[model samples]
Target: MASYFSRRTIDFLLYEVFDATALTRYPHFEAHDRETFAMSLDSVTHIADTLMYPYYREVDRHAPELRQGRVSVHPKVRDMLRALGEAGLIGANFSFEHGGQQLPELVNACLGYILTAANNSMLYTGLTSGAANLINAFGTPDLQSTYVAKLLAGQWQGTMALTEPQAGSSLSDITSTAEPQPDGTYRIMGQKVFISAGDHDAVDNVVHLLLARIAGAPKGTRGISLFVVPKYRLEPSGELTDNDVTSTGIYHKLGQRGTPAMHLVLGERGDCHGWLVGEPHRGLSYMFQMMNEARIAVGITGAGIASAAYYASLAYAKERPQSRRLNEKNQLDAPQTPIINHPDVRRMLLFQKAVVEGSLSLLLESARLADLAHVAEGEAKENYRLLLELLTPVAKTFPTEQGVRSVSEGLQVLGGYGYTEDFPLEQMYRDIRITPIYEGTTGIQAQDLLGRKVPMGGGKALQLLLAEMTQTAQQARTHEALVPYADKLEAEIERLRTVTGALLPYAQRGDTERFLMDATLYMELFGLVVVAWQWLKQGEVAQQVLSTRPPEGDELAFYESKVHTMKYFFHYEVPKTLALATRLTDPEVLTIASEKQVLM
Candidate 1:
C-alpha cells in the first residue's frame, strides 16, 4: 500500500519548527520528554498501520446498519477503539490525574492526523476523549468517577448531543427541556440529530454530553445547561438499565460510513434522566472547551484525508505513464512518459503538497499556543490564549476549505480511475467534504472570525497575530535565499492589516449584518495570509538547516521540498488576497436582501 502520511515531515514541524520539546521546560509538561512523546506517537502509529489503514476500504464498504434500534458497525471498529483506549491515545492530552499521559496538544494533534489519514471511518475514540475531558473539567467528582474512566478506556462510546430538530445551529432557540425532580436528577426530553458515535454496539454504553434548558431560567444562551445523559442508567443495584435514550434514526451519509451518524430521542417514555455538568445555565461556556478543541480536531481530519488523497494520487502519477512529452508528441518513436512529468499534473500535486503541509504547520502552531495558554503565566498566558482564539477559526477553516479543494484535485490526478471505488481517492473526496461543515460551518466560523475574534479584546488578539507573522517574515529575511518570500509574506501582513482596518468600521457603525456580509470571503482571504506565514516559518527553518548541517538523501530532499513548497504557496496562493481584499473593501452591497426588492 502507498504511504498516506509522512512522519519525517511531522517530525520536522514538531521538533524543528515548533520546538515541542521546549514545552517540557514548563512544570506541567516537565514529566515528559522527546522519548515519551516518540513512544506515544509510535504506539498510535502501530495501531493505525495495523488496524486502521488496512481496513480503510473494507470499513467504508461495510457501513454500519441500524436495525430495530441497535447500531451495528463493522467489527473492526471495536478492536480499533479497544487498542486506542488501551494505548491511552484517546485522552493522551488530559492530565495524569485523569489517567492520561499529559502530552502537549502539539504531539496529540499529530497523532490525530496519523489516525485520520489512515482511516477516518474508524473515528470513535476522539469523541470519547472530548466528552470525557469535559466531564473531568466541569463535572462533579461523582460524575468524573462514573464517566471518565470508562470513556478514557474506550469501554463506553461518547458523543456530543447538541443539535436539535428545531434549533439547528441557532442554539439560543433550542427547546430541549430539563425539569427538576425530587430525586435530584432532572428529566430530559429532547431529540438530537447528527449525533456521531451516539449509539453503537461496539461498546458497553453510549454517553451523550447533551444540552438542555432548565425551568424558568434566562432566555437564549444564558438559559442553556449541559447534562450527562447516558444510554444506560447505572442503578444503585450495580447493574445497567435502560435510560430511555433511543436511536430513533441513523443517517446514510456520503462517506466516513464506518462511524454511524445517529438521530437520538430522549424521554419518549419520559423516564430519561440527566445530571448537570458544572453550574446551571453555564453549559455553553463549558462545552466551548470541547467545541474549540474539536474544531482543531476537524482541521486535522481534513489535513489527514487530503494527505491520504495526495499520496494516493502521487503514487499513481509516478507509476502511470500516459502520453509523450508535449515537445516530443510528434515523434512516434518516443515512449509514453509518466504523468508526473507533465506540467499540469505536477502543478496539481504541488498544490496538494502545499495545502497539506501548510495546514499542518498552522495547526501545529495553534497546538503549541494552546499548551502555553494552559501552562504559562499572567500576561504570557493571556497573550497565548488570545493568540490561540484568533487563529482557531483560521486553523479550523483553512485545512477544511482548502482540503476539500485539494482532495478533489487529487481525484482529478487519476483521470477516470479516480471516480471509481477501485481507488481510495473517491472515498477521501467524500469524507473531506463534511469537514468545513463540521464543528462549525464555514459561514459560522467566518462570522466568528470577523464579527467576534478580530474585534475581541479591543483587537489585542489581531495585534498579537500580526506581531507573530511579522516575526516570521523578519526571520525569513535573514537568509538571502528566502528574502523574496519574506517580502511576499510581509506584504500579506500589511494587506491583512489594511483589509481588517477597512472592515472594522462597519462594526463600529453598529451595522452587524453589513460588517459580516462577506465574512466567508474574509475567511478565505484570512486563510491565505495565515498559511503563507506558516510557509515562511517553514522556509526559514529549512533554510537554516540547509545552510548548516543538511544531511544527504531523503533528509536533504525533505528540507529542500519544504523550501520549494513554501515558494510555491507564496507565488500561487498568497496572490489570492488581492482579489479578496478588493471585494471586501468595495462599497456596493449585493448579498443582503432588502424588503423593497421582493423577486426571487
Candidate 2:
C-alpha cells in the first residue's frame, strides 16, 4: 500500500519544532505528557489506518444519495464516525469537563492532520466537534445538556449553518428568521444552502449551530442570533420528533461527496423550533469561535491532501523508470533511470515537500498559539488571542490556495497517469479546490488580512507576528548553514512592513474598494513570506540537530532533507516576492470597475 503521509514529519513538527510536551506546563494541560500525547496519536493513527485509509476511494466512488428527502452516505462513514467517537477523538481538544482528553491543541491538530491525510472525504467528525464546541462555550446549561455529549460522541452530527440562499458569505444579509415564542424557543423559518454534512443518515441527528435574525431586531449583523436547530427535537416526554426541518435536496459536489451537503428548509410547516444560544443580536460573535476553528481545520485539510498527493507522486517517481538521464543519454547500457533521477522531477518533488511541510509548520504554530490563548493568564492570554485573530485568515488561505497548486505539481510529476483515476492525485486536486472557499474565499480572506487584521488594535497584531518571525530568524542566524535563509527571512519581514505601510494610506483615505482591490494577490504574497518564515523555523531546528550529534542513515537524511528543502523554498520560491511587492506598491489602479469598460 502507498503511504499517504509522513508520520516522521508530524513527530518532528509536534515534538521538535513546537515542543508539544512543553504545553503540559500549563495547568489546563498538566495531565498530558509526551507519553499521553504519543498514546493519543498512536490510537488515532490506528483508527485512521483501519477505518479511513482503507476506504478512501470506496467512499468517493459511492457518494451520499438523497431519497425521499433523506440522505444516506456510504456504510463505512458510519463505522468511521463510531470509531472516532468511541476513541474519544472527536472532542480531543475540548476541556475535561466536556468529556474530552483535554489534549493540547498542538497534539489535537496532529491527529486531524493524520486523519485528513488518510481520507479527506470523511470530513464529518470535525464539523461535529466545531458545533459541539459552540454549545459548550455559549449555550445555556439546558442547551449543553441537550446537545453537547451526543454530538461529541458522534451519534449526532453538528454543522455551522451560517450560509443562506441570499447571504452566501455576507452574514449580515442572512434572511433566516427566528420568532420569539412563549416556551423560550424561537420559530425558525428560512432556507440554508451549502451546509456541509447538513443531512446524513450515518448519525441519528444533525444539530446545526444556525445563524438567523430575530423579529424587530437591528439590521445587518447586529440583528443576527444563533440557535441550536436540530433535525429531531426532543420533546418534554423525552421522545424525538421531526422538527419541521426539511432536507429539500442534496448537492452533488465536485469533491468531499461522502458527506452530504444539503439545501435545508426550516418551518415549512411553521413548526421548526430552535433554542437560542447566548444572548440576542450577538450570534455572529459566538459563531466566530467555531468559524475560526473550522478555518484552521480547513487549512489542515488542505495540507493533508497535499501531503498525500506528494507521497503518491514521490513513490511513483522512485519506482517508475523512464528514459535515461539528460547527462546519461549516451549510456544505453545504463538502461532506463528512475524518474526521480531527473532534475525537473526532483524540482517538483522538492516543491511539494516545501509546501506540505511548511504549511504544516504554520498550522502547528497557530495551534500552539491557540493552546496558549486558552490556558495563559492576563496579558499573555489576550496577546495570544489577538495574534491568533491576525493569523486566522492567512492560516486559512495559504495552505489551501497554495495546496491546490502543490497538488497540481504532484500530479505533474506522475506525467499522464496523474490525470487518470488510476492515481489519487486527480481526486486530491479536486478535493483541495474547495478549501480556499471553505471558511472564506481567497479574496475574502485577503480582505480580512490586509484590510481588518493588519490594522486592528492600531496594528498591534502584525507587530506581534513580525516580532515572532524576527525571533525565529535571529535564532536561525546562530546556525551557519541556515544563516543565508535566515537573512532572506529578515529581509522579507521588512518587505512586508514596507508593503503594509504603502497600502494603509488608501484605507486611511476612505477608498475601501481601491484599498482591497488586489487583496487576493496580497494574500498570496503574505502567505509566501509567512511560509518562508516557517521554513526557516524548521531549518533552525533541523540545523541545531545536524550540527550537534545527528544520527546516521534515514535519521541523518531526515534532518539534512529539512535543511535542503528550506533552501529550495527560499531560493526557488522566495524570489517571487519581488514581482508581488512591486505590483502591490505600484500606483496603478486597474481592477476597480468604474463604468468605463472599453470592451463592454
Candidate 3:
C-alpha cells in the first residue's frame, strides 16, 4: 500500500510539540485522551487507505459532467461518503447531543489531514460538516431537525452557496433577491457560480447555506440574509419535490475534478423556497461562522497535499539511483549512488520537508487555540478567541501560498517523470494550486491580517502572540543547540513589530488605500515569522527528548531530523522576511490608484 501520510510525524506534533493530551483536562474534552484520539485517527486511516487512496486517479480521470440539468460524479464518491458517515467522522468535533463523537478540533484537524493526503479530490464531507454545524449553531429548531441528521449521515450533501455571477468576493454587491412569503419562507431568485459539491448524483439530495438580500433591505453586506435552499425540498407529508434549483453548467477545472463546481440558477421557474437562518440582514455574519471553518480546512488541505507530494518525492529519491556523489566523480568503475546522496537532491528534499512539516505545525497550533476558544471562560476565552482570529488568516495563507511552491519543489525532485501522469506529483501540483485561491485569496487574507486583525482591540492580539513567541524562545534557551535558532526567532519577532509600527501610521491617518497598499507583503513577512515560532516550538520538544530519553536507530534519527529541519527553516526560509520588511517600511508608493498618468 502507498504511504500517503506519516504517522510518526503526526504523533510527534500531537503528543510532543503541541501536547494535545493536555486538552483532555478541560471539561468539554475530558472524555478524550490519547487512546480515543488514536482510535479516531486509525479509523480514518483505514478508510482512507482502503476506499479513498486507491481511487485517487480514477476519480480525477472522470470529472463530473452536467447533462439534462443534472450532474453526474464518479461512483466511488457515494461509497466514500457512506464510509465516512458510518465512521462517525462527518461530525467529529460536534457535541454528543448533536450526534457527534465530541472529538477535539485538534484531532479533527488531524483527521482531515489524513483524508486529504490520501485523496483530496474526494472532498465532500468537510463541506457538509461545516454547513451542518452552521445550522446547529444559528438555525431554527425546525431547520436543525430537518437537516443536521441526514446531512451528517451522508444521506445528503451540504454546500455554502455564497458566490454569485455578480458578486465573487464583494458580498456587498450581491443581487440575489429573497422575497418574503406569509409562510415565513422566502422566494429565492439568483444565480450562483463555482459552488462545490453544489449538485451531484453521489448523494440523495444537496442543501445549500445560501446568502441573499431581502427586498428593500439596507445596502452592502449588512443587508444580506442567510437561507437554507435545497436541491430537493421535503414536504410536510415527507415526500421530496424538485425545488427549482437548476444546474446551469459544470466547471471543468484544472484539478480536484472529482467534485462538481456548479453554476446554479434559483427560481428559474419562480418556484424556489428558502428558509431563513437566524435573523434577517445577518446572513454574512452567519455565513462567516462557516467561512472561517472553511478557511482552516483549506489550510489543512494545502498542507495535506504537500505532505503527500513530499512523501512521494522522498520515496523516489531513496530508490532512484542516478548520479555519483561530488567527491566520487573520479571513480569511473564505481556504481552510481542513490539520488538521495546527491547534494542538490538532498537540498530540495529538505526544503520540501521544511515547508510541509512547518505548515502542519502552524495549522495544528491554530486548531489547538480553536479548541481552547470553544470551552474556556471569561478572560481566557476572550484571549483564545483573539489569538485565533489573529492567526486564522496566517494559518490560511501560509500553508497554501507556501504549499504551492513546496509541491512544485517536490515535482522538481522527480525530474522529467514528475511532469507526467505516471507519478502523483503532476496531479498534486495542480491540486495544491487552488488552495491559495480557495476560501479567500492570499490578497484578501493579507488585507484581513494587516488592516483589521493587527489593529483590532488596540493591538492586544499581536501583543499576545509576540509574548507567546517570546516564551517559546525562552524555553528553547535551556538547550545549547537550539539557542541560535531561538535567537533568530526572537529577532524575527522584533522585525515584525518594527514593520507593523511603520505601517500603522497610514492606517491611523485613515488612508485606507495607502494602509493596505503593501498589505500582502506584510502578510508574507508575518507568515514567515509565525512559522518560525512553530519551528522553534518543535525544536524545543525535540531537544528535550534527546536530552532526557534518547534512543538509537530510527528513533534518534527522527528527533535529530526535527532539530535539523528547524535550522533549515531558520537558515533558508526566515531570511526572506528581510526583503519583505524593507518593502513594507520603504517610503515608496507604486501601486496606488493615480489619475496623473495612463499607459498602455
Candidate 4:
C-alpha cells in the first residue's frame, strides 16, 4: 500500500485536469517540461519519505525546548532543512538567476502538498522560501547579497515576525518601533509572540522579516515598515555579533510541536539592528504580497493534513473489521464485516474523500492561477491576479474550517483508537485546528473575501470568477452524467449573485457592520460554488478520459472515483448554500452591534 497521500490523484489533477505541462510554453518555464516537474516531485517525495515521514512521531514526541536561552528542536529538523535546501526546493519557484530552478508555482505547490501530508511539523522551507522571496523581490542588492543565499540554502532560518503581544491580527495597532541611526540601520525594539521557527538553534542564524513603525511615523497601518532583523548580525569585520534578539519563551502548542513557536524580545539591550527591506510605511502592502502566498500555502496545509487523515482512516476501516452491515446483522454468526461496508461509515468516508480531494483541486486551481499571474502580461495578468485574489481567502478558509470537520470525521471512523495517542488521528485533529487560525482566522478571511476582494475593481474579480465557473460548467455539460451537477453549480452561481446584490447596498450605504455581518456565510457559499467548479472541471477531464482512453484497473477506478466524488460534492455539499443564501438575503439582522442590547 502507498502512504497517506495518492500520487495518482496528483497526476490526474496536474496532467489530466490542469494541464500543467502547457505552462512550459511560457519563457519563464520554457526550459522545463513534464519530465522536470516529475523530477522535482520525485525528489521531494523521496526526501519526505526518508527524512520527514519517519520522524513524524519522533519530532512530535520530543517537541522543541528552550533551555539555556537557546531553542533546540529535533535533530532531524536540521537534516530536513538541509535536505530541502540542497534539493533546491526551498526556492523551487524562484528564478534560476536567484539560485532556483524557476519551477512553476504549480509544481512548488504540489511539493508542499506532498511534504505537508508526510509530516506537516516539518513546515520550515515554506517560511524560508517566502522570506527569501521578499528579499529577492524588494530588498536592496546589498541586503540580498548578505541574506538571500544563506536563507535559501537553509544555513539560516527565516521567519515572518509580525504578531505582537498587543496586536495579533490588527496590524494597524502594532507598536513595535524602528528608530533610525546615522549608519542607515534602525534600532528595533518590540516583542513578537507565536513566531514560528523564530529562534531555532538548528540554523546558524534566524532572519526575521519583521514589521515595525518608524519614529514620528503616522498612526495605524500606514506607519508600519518592513525590516530584516537577524538573530546574529554580520559585521563588516566578518565577526558575528548578537543583535539583541532574545528568546523569552517557547509555546507548548496543541500540535506541530516539531517547529518552535517562540516569544521573542528584540532590543532588550537597545542594540537590535534592523535593515529596511523595501520602504517605510508600506510594510503592510509588502507583507500582503507574502501573506497571500502564505494563505494559499495554509490552504494546502489543511487539505494535505486531511488527506493523510482520510487515508489513515480508510486503511483502518478496511483492515479493522468490527461490525456487521445493516443487511447482514443476522449473519453475525457467519463473520464480522469490515466497517467500510456500513452505510454510516461509508458516508463518513465519502465526506472525507470529497473534502480532501475537492479542496486539493481548488488549491491547485489557485496555484495554477498564481503561475499564470507570474508569467502572464497585460489583461491576462490582471485577470489571473484578480481571480487569484478572489479565490485566496476562500481557499484559505474552506479547507481549514471544513478540514477540521473532515479530520474529526476521519477520527470517528476509527472510533476509540482514533481518540487515543496510539493512532495518528488525535494529533491530526489537533494539528488541523490551527489551519483556520493561521495566515488569518476564518472570520478574517470571510471579511477579506466579502469586504475587500468582492468589491475590489468594482466587483470585476467576482465577475471574472463567475465567468470562469460558467465556462467550466459549459464544458461539463457535454457529459450527461455531469449535466445535473453542472446545472446545480450554475444555479448556485445565480443565487450567489442574488445574495451579493442584496448585501452590496448595505456596504454602499456605509452600513459596513450590517452588510458584512454574514460575510463568513457568504464565504462558505462562495467556497462551495468555487470548489464545485473545480470538481466539475475535474469531472470533465475524467469523462474525456473514460470516453477516449478508457483506462483499466486502478486507472479506471481513479477516473470513476473522481466522477463519484464530484457527484458526492454536489449531492452532499452544494445544497448548504440554500440556508447561507437565505441568511445572506434575509431582511432581519441579528448580529449587528447596536447601542441598545437585546440579548439580556
lDDT of 2 by residue, 266-305 (tens): 9999999999999999999999889889999999999999
TM-score of each model, paired residue for residue? 0.99, 0.99, 0.99, 0.99
lDDT of each: 0.93, 0.91, 0.93, 0.91
Clashing pairs in 3: none
User: What would the TM-score be for candidate 2 when compared with the true structure?
Assistant: 0.99
Distance (Å) between predicted and true CA of 338, model 1? 0.7
Q: Report the C-alpha lDDT of model 4 over 318-343, residue by residue, as the tens digit.
A: 99887577777788587888999888
The global Cα lDDT (0 to 1) of model 3 is 0.93
Cα misplacement distance, residue 356 of candidate 4 (Å): 1.1
Q: After superposition, how far is residue 531 of candidate 4 from its true place, in Å?
A: 0.6
Off by over 4 Å in 4: 598-600
